[model samples]
Target: MSTTINSFNGDQQQSSSSPDVGDLEKHYIDAKAFILSATTKDGINLYDHLAHCISQLLADQPREGTDLVEDISKTIKSEATPAQHDTLRDRPAPDSEHSLAAEQKPLFEKVDHSEELDDEALQSPLPHILEQAYYFEQAGIGLGKDESYRIWLALKQLADKGQIDKLRFWGKIFGTQKNYFIAEAEQNVDDETDENELHEEAHISDDNRHPNEEEMDDEEDMLPKSTYKPPPVVPKEERGTGANKYTYYVCNHPGGVWVKLPIVTPAQISQARLIKHYFTGDLNKEITSYPAYPGTERNYLRAQVARISATSSVSPAGKFKFSEVN
Candidate 1:
């Protein structure tokens, strides 16, 4: 994930002063990472911090650029109160007699220097989202939600850059939720040490924590997590391939030990039990290569460990169910 951050973090300047292109990228990237973390910390919880960063981007994004800040002393403005709408405060008193006078006043009247300065900040993605949400809620409106972009990069980019409203999608699965049920087993197969010994192991600064044990705590939380595995959608050209020749996508967590499962049959429990055997090179090729499909009772075992490859990733907030096929 560090490489991904570096690739996207170009030479563009990012500072608190009106969001430079880089600043926008950083917020966008951070938001993605927070959601993917198995850590209990979540987006709604960090909204205040996120709101602050987003506000800065807005303050820095306006038309006047640096000039607005310098010219701040030049304008005057009025304070708006909760009781009355200030924008309409200056309306003409009577009827048609003074109608022409109201047209002469600008739509946004200049009340104070501070207000004018505040108006010049550029529109930021964060505020843009918040403001839109407020208007929609106020009007009590509803719109259809779509789910394809959670996994679609191009569509995501467009939505991120304001070319579209970030979409909310619905999964094709029959259930209301998109996450899948997962039960994996873990084992201490390769290490020569316990927690103390593993801590003393040499450190490498790269992203993929080769034998990723760093997120051990979060991994524990995800241990019993439900996942939503996308049902395999073989491309048009690959449709006729026989099951034996097809490649199976393994969904399991990596690193650590202990994969106790609940309520599955003895046979399925048996598969989870051999997790060590599978990782230790003692399993049959057919057993290890067993085909998997969603919603089918394929007798299979879940990876006791659950996590992304040590490689850092920004997982979007979508879910999948982990199922075993007989």
Candidate 2:
């Protein structure tokens, strides 16, 4: 009995040490079912699933620098070398004709105004003017040397072209968009004839007619002059007198086109004093303001220039004695 009891205890110890075959078989079956279920849900075979897991593990592993360089090289090798060569070969060459034309073009246009300029005109007084200007500059009352030189050239050109008897730089007037470089000149007036004088003479002769001669005319009898007397006419100012003594030419710059402003009338001067407006650099622009201006912007500018000159211009006392003789 003692031997049998010892043998039974030995069997119990062996059973506890060894795993059960049935339990091992059940665990294997459960693991196989789980893998099948996962594979089916993922829509891949077990071999493919195992391969994907292996690839992920390999990807997660750190790569050597040489392996990274090899991958970049492979990517570069995939591009078409023939296509790059074809693009370079097909590019158009630069235009030689356009370059040649640009090279041949002249930098500045040639201007010919020789026919207009007078050959017998007096030589330019630039040297004398420059000396005087230098003196004025020392006293701090003159335009700078550069500006004076440019203006002198412009004036000299004007004198030659216009056959002016005398020319003077009349300073500059600032405007909104541009400034006017003024040149006051005494031009030969032999070619010009004032039509106003003829009209005035005709009016004077008509007024001086006898009353009997007026009644004898049938046209005069037809007209009724009961009322509506016209305003007294302001006599037209003579040129070479007062503000009209010199003809004024204006330009946007020293070398620009010179425009001769119209003669200023007394009415324009009176009207200009009633209102103020900034210059628009346009000659034909109408002055629109209270007490409507009788003329355009050019007239207003001339009137103002005259007004300013009369008030501000100075001269050395007894510079020249007034002469009544010819």
Best by lDDT: 2
Q: Give me the candidate number with maximum TM-score.
A: 2
Q: lDDT for each of the candidates?
A: 0.31, 0.69
RMSD of 1: 36.9
Tell me how far the alpha carbon of residue 276 in candidate 1 is from the true structure, in angstroms, after superposition. 29
Q: What is the lDDT of residue 50 in candidate 1?
A: 41
Q: What number of backbone clashes does candidate 1 have, counting pairs of residues 3 or more apart or in separate chains?
A: 37
Residue 83 of model 1, lDDT score: 40
**Candidate 2 residue spans exceeding 4 A from truth:** 1-122, 125-127, 192-231, 313-326
List residue ranges in candidate 1 displaced over 4 A.
1-83, 86-146, 154-266, 269-326
State the lDDT of candidate 1 residue by residue for 1-326, as single tens digits.
99878755653334334667887899998987775442322222334444544554476687754565433322211111124436656754688435523542332244343544343233221223334444655788522122121222222222233322123211111112212222111212232123521332222123214454566555645565346765543322121132111111121111111122211222333344444322321111234333221111222322222112112335566665468788
Report the error of model 1 at residue 240, Å. Answer: 22
